[model samples]
Target: KLSPPLPLPPLPPKPIPKPRPLPPPSFLSAVHQGNNDWWRYLMAVGLIGSVFFVLTAALSTLALGLGWISLAPDGSVTIRDPLVSYLLSHLPFGFLGLGLWWAVVGLHHRPCRTLIRACGSLRWGRMAQGAAIWLALIISPLAVALLLNPGSLMPQVDWNQWLRLLGLAMVLTPMQIAVEELFFRGYLLQASGLLTQKPWILCLVNGILFMIVHLDNPETGYGLGWLALYYAGFGIFTTWITLRDQGLELALGMHAANNGFVILLVSYGDAVVETPALFSATSFDAAGVVLAFAVRALGFCALFFGIPGLRRDSVPPLQPQGSASEKPPGS
Candidate 1:
């Protein structure tokens, strides 16, 4: 009996289940994926940087040859023909690089249709927005004059230089504006939006970076406080329009016209580059510049926010929400 009882003691073992695999990435998820292809982004930056350098070198060479821009014995690059120098220096690479990048990115990645649809595609609404922005530019300088110092509004320029500057401004303004819009509102804004899934954050970040780039302007003399505030404010206004309208048409139009007027109409003695028209005043008095900024701000607000037709139908689409591990490509 004891032997039989001892034989009855057999035990069973427990079984273990296998671990599950991680989910694939979604479109939005992939955008935030810590730049899995860091090399590509770096390459893009390098390519763009190289284009700028090459353009600068080419312009310098041309200037030296033409006697437009000269390196003096004292090491200053003086421009005998500023208008020609400006045109040669800026036009080739200013907007072209950005245009090329957009074309390449759009073709290669095939972004969502929602991203590419211009304000005009939304119908007549975009045109109104564009008009409003243009009006703001027209009114800005004048308003600044009225509010601050009317005398400062007048530009002083030699008649010949003014004509030359005006012509150059006409040629260069579009390119300058296009470069800004494509890079800030288009590329940087869109990319940031997709990554953060927050439209406001994207806009603000773009604006901040945009402002930072202007810090080195010889005109500003590296005055961090004034320049920073001025650019930040400018960026905020522009970003608001880009976000509110869901396209860059208004921003582009406004920027083009803004710089056009500045180059053609507003002139200052110490301006980094000479244009045809010069402001009567040699420098921006604090009150005068503030007034100018205010006018520009108000104009932007009125054109984009005041007008009924210009309002966008939808906020630009943000990156779809989800964990990176669970998302798919190009979502």
Candidate 2:
């Protein structure tokens, strides 16, 4: 009986397995497999640059407003012309900030081949999308003005005003758009993605930051509630294009063209900003502005989502987790 019990016990011996090691942390994985550090440095430089650039812009604008800088009797800041004034006043310092940051990033890091390739592949489509957005913005304001006051479109224009307006459209608008894109799409979005490894979080944060920057605009009566809604909507649409298209090309093109066209078509009166746009005499109250924003929102949805290539799935899928070394398709 004892021997039989011993045999039964020997049959029940179990095997022991060695424990497996855990995977590396995500931050270490990013450093090892991805170029996250490069993006982080780039973002740091951009943040510093933005602060300086904004301070410069504010001081300059204040100087101009306070008559420290010379102005014409018409309350217009005088430089070479409206176009030159806008460029000199607004463009250079901001661009310098962006340029410096880019230079630093380029020097320290390997180029982001994926982003560059994405930009190249979708260039033409972006152009078309941008043109459509610009057209909508241009037509909407004019249509509203015309509907409200039929004779608003036929406003008289002097030659100097035309040159100033043209400059506004050609130079200042693009400059403003570039500054915004460089900060939001190029710097903030890129940095957030690299840091968090989550695209949607980046989109949300960037959109909110963007709207916050517009808080001081006099047009919204400093109303944070209305301004937040307006900017959030605009940011969501722009961010959608950035994510869906896998780059900022479409957003950049659309923003540049929108600013250019708006400056060209909408006149707010004796404003020294360069643009060939003549403003309607009729005042747009809160309701009219809200309506304009609604139209813009609807139009953005139609232009971006309605297009075949601009759909969410149409863009290249984001790189799979733990596969940062894998080159994106078509990259």
Candidate 3:
């Protein structure tokens, strides 16, 4: 009773609540809306698996009809037709992967500008930066190898065929890379992220799925342990980048450029997806393959992520997954 409570200071004015900006739509956010469990994984697998099977078969047949493939009377199928084989391996994933995501996630029910990024759109500059960095890393190693072992690489140009392959590669290679990025790095990563918030766990899960799915490739089919490491590294690095960047722009650019260069400049000996490259290597260079891992990891992490402006300060904040505003009203 200090002087009758000292006459309380004038009450502070109430803070006007700031208007909240709407949340950006993203697949990583959307996956949490519905129940995600092993069953959903299996169902997505089955649905996408069926689409892959059917679409590949239909396209393969069309390829055969177009004389891009050969079916022997003995029931042997030939993958020697580079253009057709590449297409058969990948084309279906483009359209069908989108369909699978659309149906499984029910995008129509809850609209997201993109399942690719939380920004509601891709930042093209990031993609370009990623592509440029990876392209340099990939080609530099190969170029050094080519210089050292000139005899190891040979030009195999059937102008007509090379031109044809170039046309098709320009069209399909990006599609193929996009397919892998969408499903593995984008879809699978987002799906798995819902199960756990730890970035490393999500990376591991997505990496393992990627490595397993690619088991059918010639590199894995023949049990090339080193190549397995390469793919594993690829999955992990890309997934990690996506998590850090909070988007697929960088990852997609890296994958596309990596595959694009591999298809055009030189190809490994035991390649499953052969293309009419300008120069084909006689054997797989273990040194080059090993160097690729170091370059991609170090270069991507240090340079791309380290640059002043390139740092991920631009990404928007995300709302809590189970927040009242996150889910639509009703049961």
Q: Of the candidates shown, which would achieve the greatest TM-score relative to the real structure? A: 3
lDDT of 2 by residue, 119-161 (tens): 2233667656766775666575667656866754445466677
- Model 1 stretches astray by more than 4 angstroms: 1-38, 95-99, 102-150, 153-161, 286-291, 307-331
Per residue, candidate 3 scores C-alpha lDDT tens digits across 68-97 of 778899998887667666667668767666
What's the lDDT for candidate 1?
Answer: 0.56
Question: Where is the poorest 10-residue window by lDDT in model 1?
Answer: 322-331
TM per candidate comes to 0.70, 0.65, 0.79
Clashing residue pairs in candidate 2 are 165-275, 165-276, 168-274, 264-277, 267-279
TM-score of candidate 1 relative to the true fold = 0.70
> Per-residue alpha-carbon lDDT of model 1 for 1-331, expressed as tens digits?
3455456665776667777754322222323423325465556566666777776777678768877766879898777665775677567657355544644353334332223233113333454456456655565445654577555455465888787676666667666766766666755665565557565676578778887877765556524466566666667666666666556666766666556655666645545455655554444543345456666667666655666674343443333344400000000
- Candidate 2 lDDT for residue 41: 65
| Clash total of candidate 1 | 16
Task: Indicate which candidate wins on lDDT.
Answer: 3
Instruction: Give each model's whole-structure lDDT.
Output: 0.56, 0.54, 0.67
List the candidate numbers ranked by TM-score, top first: 3, 1, 2
